[model samples]
Target: MDNEGRESGHLMLITPERVFYAGLLGRPHQRCSGAFHVYVAIKGGLRLAAEGAVEGYSELAVVPPNLRHTIASDYRSVICVLIEPETVCVGALDLLAKRLAGAERQFFVGRIHAACEQLQHEPRDGDIFSSAFDIMCFGDALPRRILDARVVKAIAQIGRFSGDPVTAASCAAEAGLSSSRFLHLFKQETGISFRSFRAWKRARHLLHFANQDLNLAHLAQHIGYPDSTHFSHSIRRFYGLKPRAIFSGSRDLAIYRSGRAAAGDSAWTQEAG
Candidate 1:
């Protein structure tokens, strides 16, 4: 395992509700297919190509959930915040939809830029970063709670036991509801089916293992995949990248984890692959 407490330019802070990435932008082009991603150009503007539409230059961009998009930046550094849809309120989703629809542009500079600047300077202060992100993205520090009580319970269960084989039936049992009712409520509340949410969670959880020096089979099993094939396909479908590639790309990133260990505030330096 890589030793902890090494300082690096690249930083990644992972929380249950969101994931934040900052520092050297690395590759000129990046493509993703899952989650709602908010990208801010720290040094210069970026070029975005999504769904066959291209923007020549943009300081900030938002990619809606499951939308395949590519971001190209000439600048050496950028910051990204990935928020889960279930964690966002209807208003925030409305704003995001407008951006994704090309109805609005340049929505992230003022507050979000300040937050990114703070993160670049003090990468260890996860709370500050998260608060800033929430305000800039959702207009508040707390996400609006709109999910049904049972659906909320199921979502929490899926997040807590992501390594287990989480099925609608299992989650429904935890929420004290029938599988059919749980499925309906889950889709109605979250706007996505239970299976898709579980898949997204599993894929998102894979980022935690990115820095680990493990084989494909071991990594696959660690995330509850049945085999390497299933792992590769699932990751590609959700992230638009293969597991090996994602792991390889994350080798240089210094991970900062919250609500966990004291060593989570460490960093390490490595050239981008």
Candidate 2:
């Protein structure tokens, strides 16, 4: 596991609403992520900075949802955990962030590194869940969010078929609201606009093919992008690296996608509050 330059050191476990990555840290470019992101150093400390925010080296750092930031580690590999804002309560997420970057920092850093070593040897397709992942890292499952039913239905449609294009207007009709109204309710319920929510979903879909050998243009088209230009720009904007760089860095990455697939309408609607 100490062999940072080796391909075997890269691993990523991706679920429907969460991700855990112990892999390469590409150039430190500004990234505006849509999820609550936490970074932990494997060996040396990391430098984390955002415009108008504190900037320095730390063993662990937290970046809140939708914040533009840059993170770099002295070592080649780092551990990153991403929690989609829609899946957890605001208070719970904030507490998780604080604990990870606070007094419990060393404990989590050790647990995460140990977990990475164990996971690397497990079957790549084994079932993995956000709850299980949380327990492993934080010793408990984080609280879930209760969103409105109409918003839940919209989320289900957009996430059900990841590569398919879903329009706000279509979702609005299905939710029994006008486009304007649906847009308003979506932002109110999720704290994110409908367009941005969909865009983030599409960009996130790229993870499924991150370790594969595929054409960028075809992959872009496959994921509902209009063209390669738009695809590249979106990926860069969200991830801070170009598509080619991501694919290249992940060529040897062990990507685990098994777990809860997109929530079915029936499954999601039950949680509507």
Give candidate 2's TM-score.
Answer: 0.91
**lDDT string, candidate 2, 1-273, tens digits:** 223324477888888888889888999999988988888898889999986888978888889888899999999889998888988865898888788878888888888777777777663456666667777767788877767888878887887655457899998898788899989989987889999998998898898889888999999988889999999999999999999999999877877786573334224444433
Q: What overall lDDT, based on C-alpha atoms, would model 1 receive against the true structure?
A: 0.67
Query: Candidate 2 overall Cα lDDT vs. reference?
Result: 0.82
Error of 1 at 102 (Å): 10
Off by over 4 Å in 1: 1-7, 23-32, 52-56, 96-107, 125-133, 136-139, 260-273
lDDT of 1 by residue, 22-121 (tens): 6555454345545788777877787777875665577777778877677777786677778777666656765665654363445455556666555546
Candidate 2 at residue 86, lDDT? 85
Candidate 2 residue-wise lDDT at 168: 94
